[model samples]
Target: MKKITVFWGCQIPGRLTFLEKSTRLGLAALGYEINDIPEFGCCPEKSLIKNEDEKLWLLTAARNLALAEREGYPLVVACNGCSSTLKTAYVKLKGNPKLLAEVNEKLWEFGLKLGGSLKVYHLIEFLADEVGAGVIKQRVQKPLRGLKIGVHPGCHQNRPSPAASFEDPLNPRKYDILVQALGATTVEYQSKLMCCGNNLTLAGKLDDGWRMARVKIQELTNLRADALTVTCPACFMQFDQKQALYARQGDILNLPVLTYMELLALALGIEAEELNLKEHRVDPSPVLRKAGIINEPLPFNEEVLKRCLTCGACEYDCPSARTGVMSPQGIIKRFLNGEIEELINSSEIWECVECHTCLEYCPQRFGMEKVFTWLKHQAMVRETYPNSLKSGYEMFVKTGRLAKIDDRQRQKLGLPSLSSQEPRQFVEKLL
Candidate 1:
């Protein structure tokens, strides 16, 4: 077995210790022994560099890395900020002989060197590479059959230059594929690709966070998603535990935010208490209950649904509208004019790609995708819809496929066909 130093850092223990524990459990189950390095302090995140105290952050991160170096193992960080800082510092100090001198001068106080002896890694990187999703799939003992989940791969983990090479920044399926191995269905929604409101949270801007989250949740809810799964701790806090505050302010949303480890824990047949499911500030029990994964409804408070402001913010930013798929603005206007009931059967509504761009740009916290979702649900339930959707709908119903382009057409356009004919069980499971 390979030796690896587990750097819990500080934030994971304070707020997301469950994730830390679950990760350890997940990796251990995969036959890896992770040695804990607890003496290391905070990574100081971006502040050390932003404050022009690169030595401080470097020393702090290096101290952690040095422990791993001494232990003859690479350091694995669970926090995004810590992971970014450590990896960046390692590369930076290793490249510049001058910066290396400066950082080493500080490290000399603790008898350490600022050389390239330590390697930094994020847990997800290892999971995607060494441990591999195949191993995870094989380890799944409890298949989450009735769940429809949305994955939020947080900006730091796979955005603005990914932390890992294997993680495709723009389109990631590591988390989703792992979820599938556990017997759950992953739903692609408008906000599935959006940022997790981390910037808004850091700026002490609650409204921005609320608006961003509200739009995201509305889209996921519209898809009838059981939960919004995440890999970042800050993202887990922002989306999972902050809903009640947003709801109290009148923009009602019911979406459970779960950590990737929690999902893995459930799949590994770990009990709820061992996974720390109770500590989530947001009550996930309702969504779980609705998915039939649990018995009782979560203690989520219900609020009176407010009428959409019809501001067309969602329309302005929606890619579908830009691509001439549907008039998101027009739908809002028509709905306000008491024509939504009539518009449900129209192909215009089904044309939405379910991207939450409109929600991001909307001045009001109105989730327009929810309207689209409601329309889709009504169509499926009532069996009333347009002929234009017949192609996609039949593909979904008969072949468990969605939006498959002709193979010849795709080759003609120099594009690879990404669509596949899925199992009927998977499609029906989602519905």
Candidate 2:
């Protein structure tokens, strides 16, 4: 049996204890041996601490990494924010020798030093990449067919491309693929990519954060989605408890929020009662009722991915495909076959400029451009991307603009000063 250490962030152990059950029991049911480790601290809450003191955040995360590495086990995090924070620390410590040395020096006092290869997985990363979706589906005794759910990709899981290297931050479909693995369907909504604003809300912007949550809930209701599924506890709380509070004063068309493991547990034949589904703030009856509904069977969930396997419709106009630098169909085929980690260093993905010539004539409403874009993002995460993109991404994230506007240069050129610190200040808050 494969052994993995489970990192339960602050929430699961203290407040969301049921999620701990779901994650532990669900992973065990899926053929994994869970190694329980008690000597772990908070993921250090990135927005809370990182923005306050980056050195402290990095040191804390590094200590956790050292502990996991010392045990020689793959660390699987149960929280999105925890995964993001640790990955961020990993990238910084791995890339900067000086910074790593400083961290290790402090760690030596505790008899711990950060060294050796570090492998960490957010729940979704472990599910989609490490444990193939096909393997999960094969174990499903009760397929969730006919249940239309909405997915809310939490914020921390996407930003700082290098930190969240498991998938494309822009076009993340691993969650959707994992959902479909259980025979359920996912709907696309306008607020699908919008942040739950949990961090914003927690960072003293209550109304603003709740506003984002309301937008997401409203969109999910409009589409009649059974539930809003999330991998992060903060997101689950933002959507679930906030809606419950909203119910006290107004009409919040009962929308349920389920963590990935809770849903996975159900598909694996674990009864709802066993997982304590009723403990949720918002009732999940809608999700339970919608399961296996006998409506006209919609097309299988991954129709586009499946069709791309053999269809060469988008290849004719694809400049990269014609030259044999990269093939759209081949990219799709490899992705569906779960070769994502292997494809991380592939430079040929940068050849496409997302020209929509393939979309215009394709029947699948998809194109090779879509595939290439996701690959480019993953490439950035692994730091294997071309230097040109690396600098541009860094500048944008740092200053909110690709180029730093020079007030002095503008003055020399007889142009008005075009510089503002607001962009940097704004990004600092998000950082």
Q: Which candidate leads in lDDT? A: 2
**What stretches of model 1 exceed 4 Å from their correct place?**
1-3, 47-52, 162-166, 286-431
Per-model lDDT: 0.69, 0.81
Looking at model 2, the pairs that clash are: none
Per residue, candidate 2 scores C-alpha lDDT tens digits across 1-431 of 88999889899899999988998889989989988778899888888898899888989999988988888889998888898898888888898999899999999999998885868888898898899999999999767765778988787676668676677888888999999998888889877888888877787887788888999898888776878899999998889887887788785668899988999998898888888877898988656645631122223345677876678776777777787777777777787786664565576677786778888877877765676676665455335678898898889878888887988888998998768788878976775
Weakest 10 consecutive residues of candidate 1 by summed lDDT: 297-306
TM-score, predicted candidate 1 vs. hidden true structure? 0.64
TM agreement with the true structure for every prediction: 0.64, 0.67
lDDT of 1 by residue, 126-204 (tens): 6766677788888876556557788887666654453333467778777677777666788987667777676687788
The collision pairs in model 1 are: 190-354, 190-355, 190-356, 285-298, 286-298, 314-358
Residue 361 displacement (Å), model 1: 62
**Each model's total of backbone clashes:** 6, 0
